[model samples]
Target: MLDPILLWSGLVNGLLQGAIYALVALGLTLIYGVLHIINFAHGSLLMLAMYGVFLLFSQFGIDPYAALPIMVVGMFVLGYGLQRGLISRASHGRDENILLVTLGISIVIENLALFFFQGDTRTIDVPYAFDSLEVFGVFIAIPRLIAFAAALLIAGLLWLMIQRSDVGRAIRAVAKEKQGARLVGINVEHIYAVSYGVGIACLGAAACLLMPTYLVYPTVGHAFVLIAFTVVVLGGMGSFPGALLGGLLIGLCESFGGLFLGESFGQIGIFLVFIVVLLFRPSGLLGSRV
Candidate 1:
């Protein structure tokens, strides 16, 4: 029989970890839903945000939490420009071209970091870095708990914006039918840019949230981007809530699987779940069929 305390600890840890994954995956799903493009560079944007947080903290002594707004604004502008300047043009071409373009962007960002920052691993020193809260006999890291709360709050706000706001309506319209949205007088290109900006904004928030617990490195995004893709697919490509569910599920699988099987086997468990989900429900748990 499994140790109850260990199981509880794993569950708590997994939920917190999954919350961050959900934030990242939600961004990817939003972009894919509207633009029909998989942003291979999403993780690179996240890496940039991590570096941004690091710089702000190291140079000006700004706290990562306090620096979040600036990071979000900066990343949003960068994402918007990137969409308008480069991605927009490439998007008109074949899917293969779009994939190649995003992949190229990722490579550029990674190499740029390597050139400037080298391959060193860096992390931020924060007050809550090692603090934990015990709840019902389970100890949860404070930083991860904060991240979990932030993730849920952001997800809720995004869901509300998509469902209730005018811009959200336009975004949804475009995602549903691009030509129809255009015929209805919506500036499709601008909406596309805004959508991409929103996606990157999520990454910015995630970067700050993760900095206290994780290290920043040139190749850090490679692992996250893969996990984000897996979450996006498992959650159902365009489904918002589905991403959250998928993230938590993957988090639990990883934590428990690692405890029982081994650290390396945890990823195997995630892939196994992915394969099962694909075979049974290709549309994802919440995604609707066209």
Candidate 2:
């Protein structure tokens, strides 16, 4: 018997998954917006945080959830340093160079994971891993719910920062016109570092939020990174809100595609949507050339 309830549950689960993808993709879009770099290493950074949480739990007996703050702070500093020292210094008329360097960095990180973790899969076994709450007669998994909520919270915070704060305004200014920003005495290099830091912090935060429900594998970042990239392209490279909506839309498509087509085709369905979106809206839903 095909249960209508199960179908609805699948829809919610898909949305939850989408929420995590959106979180990571938004970070990707931000970096791309300001830095104009694809940041192939962003996914590896996510893997690093995942491993960071895994080791913290194995060594210190701390819950991965409880270690969220530490991961975010650590990754933020790592990103800032990477940008300030490596990216900023090398980004003089050499965007493609940075891309290749970051891709190489990602390869190294993945290999390190393989060497250390030995291709074994691991996951955090939290009590609430599969727990759920009933909403409007539908059951929603707690991890997904928390992840989804965190997605919104982070998005809101990001918007507030960009629209309100001094540093945030500087980021926007630099993104719009680097020379103009320099005319106003805004440090373009520092702004780039700050934006990159926020972007990387978001990836780490997503890793911690997803630890309870996801397995820790060397290549786990590979799975979501493509989806994140697709979301970024669909949402518009420089558009933050576009990333969120694109993620959610992709989520719904995956859920419904699996329901109607097959589970194996769900990801294929997202790429198909990407194809269609690109064919029609190359500039994206909200992208405006700055």
Please tell me which predicted candidate would have the highest lDDT against the true structure.
1
What does the lDDT come to for candidate 1? 0.91
- How well is each residue in 1-290 modelled by candidate 2, as lDDT tens digits? 66888678778877888888899998899999998899999888899899998888878977877888898899999999988897767666498888987898899999999999989999877887879889867978788788899888998899899889999889988987999999999988888888899999998789889888888889889888988998898888879899998888888888877877789976788878888988888877667643
**Which one wins on TM-score?**
1
lDDT of 2 at 21: 88
Q: Compared with the true structure, what per-residue lDDT tens digits does model 1 show for residues 133-239?
A: 98989878898999999999999999999999999999999998988999999999899999999999999999989998899999898888888899999989989
Off by over 4 Å in 1: 91-93
Give all candidates' CA lDDT scores: 0.91, 0.86
Write down the worst ten-residue block by lDDT for model 1.
87-96
